[model samples]
Target: MAKMQRNTVLVVLSFFAIYFIWGSTYLWNKIAVTELPAFMLAGIRFVIAGSLIFIISKILGFSLKITKQQFKNTILAGFLFLTFGNGVVVWALKFVDSGFAALEVSAQPLVVLLMMRVFQGKKIQPMSIVGVILGITGIFLLVGQKEIIAQDGAILGMVLIFVCMLSWSYGSLFVGNADLPKNFFVNTGYQMLTSGISLLIISTLFGEQWISPIDWSIPVITSMLLLIIFGSIVTFTAFNYLLRIVSPEKVATSSYVNPIIAMILGWYFLNEDITAQSAIASVVLLTGVYFINTKKSLTIFSRFSGKRIPKDPVG
Candidate 1:
């Protein structure tokens, strides 16, 4: 009974980390990217974070060894999810508000569903089909706003972000079946290290000017530290933990919460404008996500209200 209680506490804390910390990452990334080049910022952040993860894992007695196949798979996953998927979205932050970018990326479930249909010949459930349609409508409402589209490079940024979404969606499918390091912490560290190196290579190839950390402003430095520690290490660990201890549909509730947190933070801190149309789109998009995951039990609200989730087989 004591062990079960401790596990429940850890589960709740992990859920909080993924729900809140991951949501705040958009604001941190926006702040850091403002003063640093996109690739360099992301590369440095992940490299440091990955190194720290390895150190912590070693201290905790986790093995670092993996098979050759696992190494290759990790590299591929890293490039798809981090180097291109996340890096390009950071670049788009140069042209779009943090809140806007988060809202747009909130359509990821829709993209993943479509990709599964195309690549795996998976049948889309009736409810998920409705989600896809609402998702499409939400995206149209979001990107069609004249005020947003008229911004310089806004169109290009939105296009590239969509591409990044596709990359992330594909990466999710790949990782679902890929042989990776047995230890989730070690697996995540490998992905971060490989992707960080790839991002640095891309940065060098693009000839982006690298600014020294000494010259970075206080806000930028703070943001970078927050991102590396909380955003990458803490929240990602929590995410993996939740995936092990709970239903995936419950873990995925972060998708619904993150954008709302981001939008509020962006508005409060950066004074980002929240248009009426964008609010409507957020509702529509998240509603679509709800439908997509309705086939599975989602207990976000109950959990938030201090209700215990039914136990699942731990992975």
Candidate 2:
């Protein structure tokens, strides 16, 4: 009974962590990217976080071993989800508001649905078809705003963010069946490490100037630390834990909540403008996500496939 009660407390706290911490990451990334090159900033953040996870796993007596195929799979997942999916979004933050980026990325479930149809030939359920329609309407409302599209590079940023969405959606499908490390923590660590290394290499190839920690302003430093500790490590750990303890549908609620938190934080802290059109789009888009999530037929991955479908990781 005591163990059950303790588990309940942990579940509540974990939900809070994923909901709040993951949502705030957009603001943190925006703050950090203002002064640092995007690739270098992301590379350093993930590398340090991944290394810390490795150290902690060792201290907790978790083995870090994995087969070569798992290693290769981790690399592929990392590049798709983090190196390109997340890294490119960070770069786009320079051109778009943090809240805007969050709102745009919230359309991920829609993209995943379309991808499944195209690649897996999965039949789109009737309810999900409605979601796809609403999602498209919301995206059009959000991106078609003249005030937003009129800004220099705004269109480019939106385009790149869409591409990132594709990468992430595809990664979700791939990881569903891929043979990864059995330990979720270790699997995440490996993905981070591999992706971090790839990002640094890309940073070098792109000639992004690296800034020393000593030269970073207090805000940038604080944002980076927050991103590493809370956004990446703590929230990811909670996310995996919640997946084990609850229905993935419940765990997936973060999708509905994160953009709301992000938009509020971005508005309060960064003074980002949120127009009426954006507010309506948020309603429409999130409603679409709600429909998709609630209908079992529209679940991210079909369970009938006899493959393990992991919940989508926090952005």
Candidate 3:
């Protein structure tokens, strides 16, 4: 009974961490990059966070050694998720609002479904097809707002965020299947370290300006620290734990709520504007997400290739 209670409490706490902490990361990233170069900022953040976690994990008696295949998978996953997925989105946020970027990334489940179907030959559920269509339509409506359409470079930025979403979905799928270190913290630390180094190399190759003696203003420093400690360590650890205990589809439900948290934070803290189209689109997109993640609701069409594909309610 005590174990059950403890499990329930941990689950609830992990949900809170992933929902609120990951949601707030968008705003923090926006603030941090306002004064820092994107790649350098991200590189430093991850490296420091990874190093700290590595040391803490070691102190906690977690083994740092892993198989060669594990190392390779971790490096590939890191580059895909952190370097291209997160680093590019941080860069793109210079031209895009934090809330909008969150909305764009909220389509990750749809992208993941496509990746599984195309690469792994997984069968697509009938409702998943409808969800994808609705998701695309929601994106069109969301991006049609005057605020986004009028901004310079908004189109390119939005495209980059979408690319980021694709990379993240692929990475998430890969990591979900790959065998890694038994220790989750150890695996995450290596991922961060590898991606951080890769990002720094890319920054150097691209001739990104390096600011010496970074201006440690309260906001910038606070944002960086928050990202390192809460965003990287606590929230990510919680997310990984959730993935262990729940189905990936259920774990992804956090994406539906993240945009709402991000939009609210962006509005309250950064004074970012939200239009009617975006508001409507949020509802539509989350509805689509619900459809994609939920299983076996209402069957409409199922007799293709002698298989019965379940159609679920839009709820």
Candidate 4:
């Protein structure tokens, strides 16, 4: 009974780590990019975080051995997820609000579902169709907001974030079938390092200028450290653990809750407004996510009707 209780506590904590910490990363990325270049910021973050994790994994006696196929897959996953997925997000933050970015990312599960169906001939549940409809409607509402539409480059920024979501979804789906290292920590560390190096190369190709003697101000340093320690290392560790222990549906709940937490934080700390439209959109989007995850197949069109789809592996 005691062991079961401990496991329950760990699961709950893991959920909190991914939900809140991952969501909060948007804010930190926004702050970090204010003084640093986009890809450079991401490169620094992943390199440092990956180095620390690599050291810790060695200390913990986890073997770092990886096969050639594993290395190739890891590089591909890293480019899709961290280099393009997260790196584009960081670049887009120059124009968009952190809360809005979080809300946009809340649509990732739907994106992943569609990608699987398109690329792998996977079937979607009827409820998933309903979910996709609602999710798209919510996105339209969010994107059509007058405040957002009025801003220069806001729509473009949004388009880039959606691309980020697509890249991440593709990486998530692809990595599941690829041969990765058995140790989650080691696997994640390799992905981060690969992504970091790739981003650095991209940054150079673009001729991104470095802010010599980085600001090192309190908020800048604090956000960078938080992202490295909590965002990359701790939250990712928790996320990997949850994938091993729980149903994917339960773990995917983070996609719903994370945006809410991010919105709250952005409002409280950065004073980013959460308008009525945004609030409504968030509710609609989360409702869609809930339907998708729960496998509630609402029959809409005869053409769209199908058996329930299996849960996807965690991205």
Q: What's each prediction's TM-score?
A: 0.92, 0.95, 0.89, 0.90
- What is each predicted model's overall lDDT from 0 to 1? 0.81, 0.85, 0.78, 0.78
At residue 155, what lDDT does model 1 achieve? 96
Writing each residue's lDDT as its tens digit, candidate 1 over 80-116 gives 8888888888898899988888988888878877877
Q: After aligning candidate 1 to the native by TM-score, how far in Å is the CA of 293 from where it should be?
A: 1.4
**What lDDT tens digits, residue by residue, belong to model 2 across residues 26-53?**
9999999999999999899889989999
Q: Can you give the lDDT of residue 56 in candidate 1?
A: 98
Report the number of the highest-TM-score candidate: 2
Q: What is the lDDT, from 0 to 100, of the residue 62 in candidate 3?
A: 92
- Order of the predicted models by TM-score, top scorer first: 2, 1, 4, 3
Which candidate do you rate higher for lDDT, 2 or 4? 2
Ten-residue region with minimum lDDT total, candidate 1: 306-315
Q: Tell me the spans in candidate 3 whose CA falls farther than 4 Å from its real position.
A: 1-5, 246-250, 296-315
Relative to the unseen true structure, what is the C-alpha lDDT of residue 252 in candidate 2, on a scale of 0 to 100?
A: 72
Error of 2 at 118 (Å): 0.6
Model 1: lDDT to the true structure: 0.81
lDDT of 4 by residue, 1-315 (tens): 011233888888888898888888888888778888998888888989889989999999999889999999889878888888888889988888888998888887788778767887877888898888899989888898998878898988899999888887787666666687877799889998999899889999999996653656678789889989998889888876776676556666787877888888889988988999999999998888777667342221111312111111111
> What pairs collide in candidate 2?
none
As for TM-score, the candidate ahead, 2 or 3, is 2
